[model samples]
Target: MVKLATVPVSQVAGIGAQKVKELESFGIRSVLDLLEYFPFRYEDYRLRELSEVKDGEKVTVAGTIYSEAVYQRYGKKSRTSCRVMIDSTLVTAVWFNRPYLKDKLTPGIEIQLTGKWDMKRLQVTVSESEFPGNGGPAQSGTVQPVYSVGGTLTQKWMRKSITQALKQFGEIIEEVIPEFIMKSNHFMPRKEAIRIIHTPADTAEGKQARRRLVYEELFLFQLKLQAFRTLNRSRADGLVHGYDNEELRAFIQSLPFELTEAQKKVIAEIIRDLRQPYCMNRLLQGDVGAGKTIVAAVALFAAVKSGYQGALMVPTEILAEQHSRSLQKLFEPFGVQVGLLTGSVTAARRRDTLASLQMGLIDIIIGTHALIQEDVYYRNLGLVVTDEQHRFGVNQRSILRRKGMNPDVLTMTATPIPRTLAISAFGDMDVSTIRELPKGRKPIETYWVKHDKLERVLTFIRKEVSQGRQAYVICPLIEESDKLEYQNTLDVHAQMQHAFPDLKVGLLHGRMPSGEKDETMRLFSTGETHLLVSTTVIEVGVDVPNATLMVIYDAERFGLSQLHQLRGRVGRGAHQSYCILMADPKSEVGKERMKVMTETNDGFEIARRDLELRGPGDFFGTKQSGIPDFRLADLSVDFEVLEQARDDTAELVAQEDFWTAAPYVALRHYLQREQIFQGELMD
Candidate 1:
């Protein structure tokens, strides 16, 4: 493998200062980075003829210009037009805002045109038009890779940079995967794959390279994740919280509603972990409407029954308070004392709660990250339950784990993570999934509406409010931005207040003070507010069963899974709930995303589709969401590889002398380097 430091822009002979800067913008500063910067797309222009060119199809054609160019100027704008005859067929080419193109394209001059053709206009608006002698169709036709570029970095410059970098480093690009794995998978050789990917001689070559590369990326990522899991399971201090039959039976009988088969299965798994001699690091993943909270309650009860205290940590104060209230309701019958601790809690209340917790006066403590505070000491803390676990980092969970004598951890998330992602991101933990929703609950009615239909939507919301039903209006941003035209939480709140003066509209966003957020959430949940205008802060754990409408502004800005989660906030009660996705109809991506939300209520399906459509980066965003930043692996495409990698890593680690293996040494070093880099980044 080429060392990252040895690869520099100057090594690419043709790279100048400006070109180097452009490459740097795409995070390509070294030869290794350049080689690893895979193509976002490829233009397979191997076959094309004017006669065979389908309308609206992107194709490449080489021909001589047979007619004089025409130029027209309308006000400040100018248009250039020309006709090219190829294979006994004539196609018009038009260029907007480039009148100089008319002079450049003289009649009888051989040129190559590549662009989407519009049959209705008989035009091929060339994305790229070049003279036949200067790198014409033949040169461009060879596997043309396309990089995602900003407006400042033109396609020509990107192509030139890649070409130069490949010329210098192509021969030196190293293959890391073992030869056996490559051969078993029927993958092309690394050097040939790189060459074909960048400059494929034909469409088939490009496809083959893409297939191999995508698989490789996924396979490596899975291997790394599996390795991490194997190492963790081996080293973690296992403390079995011996089971108490009396407490388990009492906890189950105390519930008002019967446990669903899925919930029962998950509870059994948790109990099994608690009884085992090994440390219980378990991930309880469930859909939004699924009864994960109740299962957690039962687990907490079980811990308390075994004479151990449990702490439940939530991401938001609203969720903390909600958990405290719900748990109080459930545990009250069993004489369990539940205390709430949040940043907003009064000093006196916090001091009293801390005193009670230390004295074993409080059996179950429900709080935010405040539960992890150094000043807070648990009397006999044994179980640490983290709700919406993705919102917390590994270190945060670890801190909680250290509070007791190797406490058992039960992390939970309403976001239904795919098996591959769950294994990689939470591979250290045993996983249990709650796949079923409650019996009486009905699926929400979802809709995708154009922004122009907002007036009607508002009218519908007013009608719902008149019927004593509440609604939630969610925005992507907290405040109105000069950069984007989409409505924000503050803007929407103000607009709603102005439009409906009698309606109680409240705004809640991440920027608000913790106390204020709690108050706003409380009002919305208790029917004090008819409408709650908020950002995605209410995406998880804010349950308002009375609310019946969920209107999302700029719905396209959110992933399908996230939108589904937001939709889950409503539709909790008996009345039918509606999710109105207000999006820009002009954007194809936006429309498609909203369509997914409208078509499906299955969180798993939405998550799978979201991963496939946006990839992991866009789905999680820059905040990382507690998932490690993967350089090469794509969770969507590499799921199968991840499973295989996990199995292999587990088996290898189970070997008598696995740690001393040569490949293991290198892998360990790589992981250590990645951890250090990640720590620096997080800092």
Candidate 2:
């Protein structure tokens, strides 16, 4: 059979070069692409008897023209009105600006009229007409597909082009999924499903077609993930790490606070992954300030005890420095050496750290992208931990992993993602979530206030600072913009400085140099700066325990998850922290966001709501997070199907003959041709 995927759209009867260009604008280059461009909606234009129609009902009825259609013009406007008989009931049909329709609506000619019915006048305001006697397209009694079109492409033209393509190459729309799997799931054939989706007989058939398509899309996606898992395991020379040691136990017992049950469970899961013969590919996600650092410390400690060095990579220099200090404090008593390597490190210090790392002197090293530099090398690197994993690309992670001999990887994220998103986005990685916050941690008090309450908010901030606690004043922008009315960091910094002459106000934003930003954060972290006015550069990995107040201007402009992250920067200490959302939102969505922020502090719940409001594209950003932007499957609604596909693909890949079996030959061919694995597992 011919490969439908390679068959160009130009092979269709009506698609010329110009039409092909237009179709190409929508990313539809091949027959398979055109076929998969499913309609967003369908119009039920099936004909109904006049007796079944109700007042103001949009109905399609067939009738014979009983009266001569008269065309009349009133200066600029024209109307063609006529009488039609449907089963002995006469109804007036009116068409506006259709002077040419008068010639076609001849007496005794059978016609189909679709429009809204006015029961009082016994009239139909005709929007469309089909002369059944003249062999018009059978559109009167069919559910018509409506394509999202642009650039001179009409619905009629799209339908014609698609219909031509189906006619020419419908037989070659090969079954990508194995026949056995399809039969066991009671799924329809691929060819039939494609045909039914384009031209479904009824709504039920359309739903069935959608079911098959959705499942196929998710199944293919999970297949790639499964293949990656298989490929990664096959290529790995995994090391079995010894985690049950006196040092690890002493480290845990020496902590100031007890670990949460969730944290303990996740730590156990990580240990199990470490002891496995295969490399560990795990995602450790928790809410902000959920003691993820301790869990990670446990993992790093385990790796170090196994006579191997550990590597912890973060996204920002500040986070790297922060992690280095924390890890040094935790490992200092155990005589474990922790090194910090960043772009800003002194030349001599960098050289010393490099020499130490190469000589197995550094037990655990923390840094930003500098960790993946060509000059840096680790001796016997066994475990890799990445903080804020989404900030790094797959290649970056791969580079860091390659530095070691297939070191066990544990990726951590402060963003608490919902299970559905986690499953879809990080399907290849084993996920361990820590939902519980640390014991003795106080929930941040959040409030949404209007502009009038600014004075009160400032007074509250002043009071908090007077008590020897720092506060964060967050703005949406760095500089004031004429287009946007939101507060900016510089302006707010000046205002706060003027408002409190005795207190020091430090300003920070993305536009500042790295040194300046680091210095400003240092002042805030050390309590030298009474109030820090900044943009979202401090959104992640800024741990200031003394800061008890968070004032976000124009809070509605931020997503729920972002607001939650910003709120998390505070509430780290024992004092009751507070988050002030000073927003007078204009849109309902903005208002709802503010409401959600004020209502709850659960990051997972906020993530779910954010997904619903802004969709999956903007959640973690499809491009940045490597989440596939599926055409037919919605991660929000099709989560169950996603899970089922995940399970099915896992089972299928577990079979020894999955790659070479006769049933999977077509599937493998399609996968290779599409290059859906992003070249990661292509070999």
The root-mean-square deviation over C-alpha atoms between each candidate and the true structure, in angstroms, is 5.0, 3.9
Encode model 2's per-residue lDDT on 203-240: one tens digit a residue: 88998999899999999988988877876677546899
lDDT at residue 569 of model 1 (Cα atoms) = 95
- TM-score of every model? 0.81, 0.88
Error of 2 at 571 (Å): 1.6
lDDT of 1 by residue, 371-397 (tens): 888999998998989898767766787
- Model 2, TM vs. native: 0.88
TM-score result, candidate 1:
0.81
Q: Using TM-score as the measure, which candidate wins?
A: 2
Provide the overall lDDT of each model, using Cα atoms, as 2-decimal numbers: 0.79, 0.88
